[model samples]
Target: MKARRVLVALAMMAAALPVAATAETLTNDMVVALVQAGLGDDAVIAKIRASAGHYALSTDDLIALKKRGVPGPVIAAMIESGSQGAVSAKAAFSADSPDPLAPHPSGLYLLSGPRMVRIDPTTSNQSKTGGILGYAFTGGIASLSIKAVIPNVTARVRTKHGRPTFYFYFDEATRGLSQAGSPSLWLSGPASAITSPNEFTLIRFDVKKDRRETRVGSMNLAGAKAGVMDRDRIAFDYEQVTPGVFKVMPKADLTAGEYGFLYSVSAGAGPGMWGNGTGSARIFDFAVHP
Candidate 1:
């Protein structure tokens, strides 16, 4: 009778083996596959939170993870699991309330740092240089300054969870013309030139081993659509908080990896104006860790 009972208990334990084995063993590649399959951020995050495995992530792997659309929080979690030190939660950007020409605070920013950058006339022109003749006329040439606060910075910053907001400034004089329907309108007057206009978009960037970035995809924030540009990118929405202050936090969560707050300076209405026809865009690069 005792032997019969023992055999029954063993059978019961054996019956549950397949169920226990069904649980997924999480991995970076598996996460990417989940994202490609249209898993929601919350669901994917939950899987990551439940995972107790290790990852072999390198710089290329990190970049690839981002390109596959994993949110930063998830990546940070992965990094935390694979490495020793705690992943930093502090992130910030420069908000120069006073002088504008100083370095716009590039490089990796901690999530706990200031999340803003001030874009003004002086700082916007920080990189504007012309030939000797153009430099000779300081005031006239300077008017063509094309600097954006986070001027095309090529570095990554770690951000905290929830939504990410980007803040910047734009003068009233340059408003309402960044995306004019007809160039004739802004071109009508001498003072009527296109400016930054607080316009921005969220874009995915692919980072090579050398850290060289290539544009892989663009997100239509308003339309809520993601498209393939070159087998490399993801998409998200953004909102304009005010005239100059803009935010790029999408309703969906971001997977880990590198991204950009791509903003543009409007091409003024004339051939001699300070834009690159389609407008010259500047990249504010950042990374979202697990």
Candidate 2:
């Protein structure tokens, strides 16, 4: 019924879902396959192959993964490993983490035309301002990406007049994420374009966690838009869809450019994870560009 309760229910469902794999139970074939595919390292592959337990993976979309860099060896190992597997088979983050409404500063984003402006493994190093929590820096599994869709961008690009027609447009949500802890299209472009003062809007879904003690209620990601959007950035109050997972989107325009707008998710001891000497927050950044 309530938003928090609904999120908790969804989390329960997630945990109830059958895990696809366990370490030590993977086969050598699975290992080599991932390495060839460029997903994980050799050491990771070997460990996964030697892992234990039944793998929950289905048909194992080897070819499909190749396009996303699942690497034959990595996917195989993931199929063998479980949620704790070293290979970031999938991403896990929630907007309810530290400073749920943390804003992504504005800047300029550059985009290479005809390119999807997708955030790949190469965009991992981008950063704006750092956060005090474990997620302070721009590093995390980018599961989603949203940009402000500014109008008249095409006209400015073609005209010699340096018009401010660049609009920050994301796919209504974090469109760059690949479901895995990697670069998404939204966070892989020019950092300056997305974080600029008047470029993109940073929306953070603010989900209430301390609703009178008994952590209850939940919300849905569907139809959920950014909390606030301006010519520059959009901010969303934290919305809890479930633990280890979060989602948000844009409500305004996003200009075109090549930049990396990343999300910081801290499930462990990375940057921005530490809080007021209490609970820790997972920080992750999904990069994207126009």
Candidate 3:
């Protein structure tokens, strides 16, 4: 009897809502209200999929929703709805526009004024393992470090901006026409499949008279490992612009120097790997000029 009365009340409350042809935007409050009124997770998720989502899904907002008895699946659905809305909003970029946010080929591109310039990949041929002398001198107490060296003193691509913004397009669908009739090719082989900028490391190169070098890994008594040293690595922030696309920018202003986005194929492989090499790695290199 009590359960029947609750269902009747819920139906009456739902019927009282405005009956417009357009689906109303779903908000956090409405979601909480629906959950309080005894809607199942599937029903709530289906509603979210049908309506435009304007949910406040911040950490606090999510906590509040959970406290209000919203299920985990419903919260997940809200997050997905918000993500789709954000992607749809960015999808408005004109197909032919030269904007960096516009559709681009599957590669890394630096934003140059109104143009999106591709950052070509440079293969590192020389791998210099160092710190071994320190280890030997200390009776294996010190760690050994490995560095990848590029033969060129300067990169072919140069940017005047110390903190240039870069865009990464991972979608093969966008490769058509934008590539100037070139055959479909992965710009960085295995690195091309990455979906997040976290997979890449931004490193400042130590400029030499004829070559630029950066540490790729360090080896201790334990074993060999792969990664850039903290001093050589530049931190950056990234955001998803649209599906399969991301915008990356340095967290702080970069100093004038040679830099590259290094993506290693496997742990401890370092950046010396090219497709033809023993291991695989890719470096999208550029020089930052003052």
Candidate 4:
């Protein structure tokens, strides 16, 4: 009897809510109230999905929601709702903004002043697969390493900033602009294949007099694979600007040298084992000038 009365009062209150409040505005407090009013997880989740959920889902926020007796499933639904909302909001903002960081061609870009400078894709001219000597010296115990040698000592695209910011757009439209006339190559299928920035590596090339080199991967005598060595890899941080869009920045300031964003598709061997039934590799090369 009391539960019936509570439900009736809640319905009346909802009816009295302003159009904006009654429409797409579902808040954390309202969710707690609904759960307290004896709503099931499905009911709460349905409400969340139907409304624009303004949920504070930080660690502390989640903990508070759990403490308030919100069901685990409801919490999970809240998270999904929050993620969808964020992506939608980001897409809307990107679509409206005239900023250089807004959605553009699907490729790597460096932000220079008010303009976005596209980084052209290039392939390694030569590959040196060594570590065989090391393996022999170690009695087939050491791993075999492969280094990709790009023909030019210097890259055409140069930036004065030591730690430049880069943007990546993986939209299906304008996919050919970044692939160096090979759109069917890297990430051809689903745009979701390379969702995270971790899929790409920031590599500082070993600048020789005539070429720049970096270790792509290594393989053991037994065909076990060890991906790109840590020595040549530079750490970076990234955040999703919108769906299929990301902003990347190096964790530490890069020293003036040749660098590139390297993405490779491994074909059973190791990364960058291009040609001869191996796989393919793509790099967006640039130089950080002092």
Top candidate when judged by lDDT against the true structure = 3
Write one digit per residue (lDDT tens) for candidate 1, span 115-157.
3432221112222222334434653432222222323433435
lDDT of each: 0.45, 0.32, 0.75, 0.73
**What are the models' TM-scores?**
0.31, 0.18, 0.58, 0.55
Whole-model lDDT, candidate 3?
Answer: 0.75
- Pairs that collide in candidate 3 are none
After superposition, the stretches of candidate 4 with alpha carbons farther than 4 Å from their true spots are 1-98, 101-103, 172-192, 220-223, 267-279
Question: Cα RMSD (Å) per model?
Answer: 22.4, 24.2, 14.1, 13.2
Task: In model 2, state the lDDT of residue 242.
Answer: 33
Off by over 4 Å in 3: 1-97, 172-180, 183-189, 265-280
lDDT of 4 by residue, 46-140 (tens): 98888777888889999999999998999999999887765554444332233644546456778776677778778765676677788888876
Instruction: Give the true-structure RMSD of model 1.
Output: 22.4
Candidate 2 per-residue C-alpha lDDT over 1-290 given as tens digits, one digit per residue, 9 for 90 to 100? 69999999999888866664322355445544655665547776666656653443445445555564555656655654654542332243222223222211111122333211222212112112222232323233211222222112111222121111222223222332233342333344343123222332342221223210101111123321221224333433223333312333333433333222223211223543222112211112122223
Q: What is the lDDT of residue 52 in candidate 2?
A: 54
- Write down the RMSD of candidate 2 (Cα, Å): 24.2
Q: Distance (Å) between predicted and true CA of 70, model 2? A: 39
* Residue-wise C-alpha lDDT for candidate 3, range 66-156, written one tens digit per residue: 9989999999999999878666644553423457556554677888776777776787766666677898998767987667877788888
Give the candidate number with the greatest TM-score. 3
The window of 10 residues in a row where model 2 has the poorest summed lDDT is: 210-219
The per-candidate count of clashes, in order, stands at: 25, 129, 0, 0
